[model samples]
Target: MAITQIYLNLPVSDLEVSKKVYTAMGGTINPDFTGDTSAQVVFADAIVVQLMTRETFATFTKRSTSDGPIEVISALAAGSREEVDRLADAALAAGGTEPREAQDIGWLYNRAVDDPDGHSWELLAYHPAGGQG
Candidate 1:
């Protein structure tokens, strides 16, 4: 069969704060999940994540952890440049912090932010050379 959906499981220090910030950025919280230990916040049909508390996650993974910067570049592609800008603004307004300004990378434009829990997210707009404006 084919892979139908995906969920990015991220570690967070505080689930409530993280949920608020993500909701501010336009994600919806799924109510079907039973407990506060984890939440499924949906960004798109195929894009959602189970934001888990550090203690809960550590126990599940059978490992210990420390608070630190994200080691990888996690990204979300926006529907348009305006959408990218809107998300950046909303994220900041929701207590998320921008790590840097948006940049034009010739074919793509992007900006990055650190969520309240320190998970990194890059919002981007891509324009193929021959595509419509």
Candidate 2:
């Protein structure tokens, strides 16, 4: 079965702050699927992020909602190196933090940013032509 869409459910300490971070990265809030305790941020037709309060997130899982070590790094592909920089910079200016320095290896460029609650996101661009401008 081909997966038509993806939903990333993240438990956050502060719901409003999380929403702002996502919006800064170019996502739009979908009010139809959003409410007091949870929000749906649409990055693309096929990509959606479900940001929920830690208390609300507990309802969907039997596992603990306690914060811990890094569990996942969500990656987004950009059309070019400049696009990657634009998105990452926007996120940073809107209160997100840079997790590391940007990386550029001719064919690939990437930058990592972390939301206020520590959720990591990597913005990347790949050029198969190998450094071709």
Candidate 3:
């Protein structure tokens, strides 16, 4: 079956604090999917992220959440290098920490930022002609 949407579920220690970080990264909260224990952050119509309290998320599986290590790294494609920089700046201004400096590979640019809960996000922009312009 074809998939119309994708939901990335993450466990957070505090919903309100996590909401601020996601909002800074340009995500909107979907009221229909948000509650006291969990909040649904929508990046676009097709990409939805569900942020649940560790306790609330535990109900879905037996796996224990780990805060000391990153289990996943998420990447978002931007329209331009400027857009990627803007997003990375916003994340840092909103209390997210940068894991490393931005990377420029001629045709591609990328930056990584970690949320307050330590979830890693990579913002990237790619140019087909090596950004000669």
lDDT values of the candidates? 0.81, 0.91, 0.88
State which candidate has the highest TM-score.
Answer: 2
- Pitting candidate 1 against candidate 3, the one with the higher lDDT is 3
Ranking by lDDT: 2, 3, 1
Which stretches of candidate 2 lie above 4 Å from their native place?
Answer: none
- Which parts of model 1 are misplaced by more than 4 Å? 130-133
lDDT of 3 by residue, 1-133 (tens): 8999989999998899888888888899999999999999999999888999999999999988866666789988888888888888988987889989889888888999888889999989888877821
Give the root-mean-square deviation of each candidate in angstroms: 2.0, 1.3, 1.6
Which segments of model 3 are wrong by more than 4 Å? none
Q: Model 1 reaches what TM-score against the true structure?
A: 0.88
Best by lDDT: 2
Worst 10 residues of 1 by lDDT: 124-133
lDDT of 1: 0.81
TM per candidate: 0.88, 0.94, 0.92
True-structure RMSD for candidate 2: 1.3
Lowest lDDT block of 10, candidate 2? 124-133
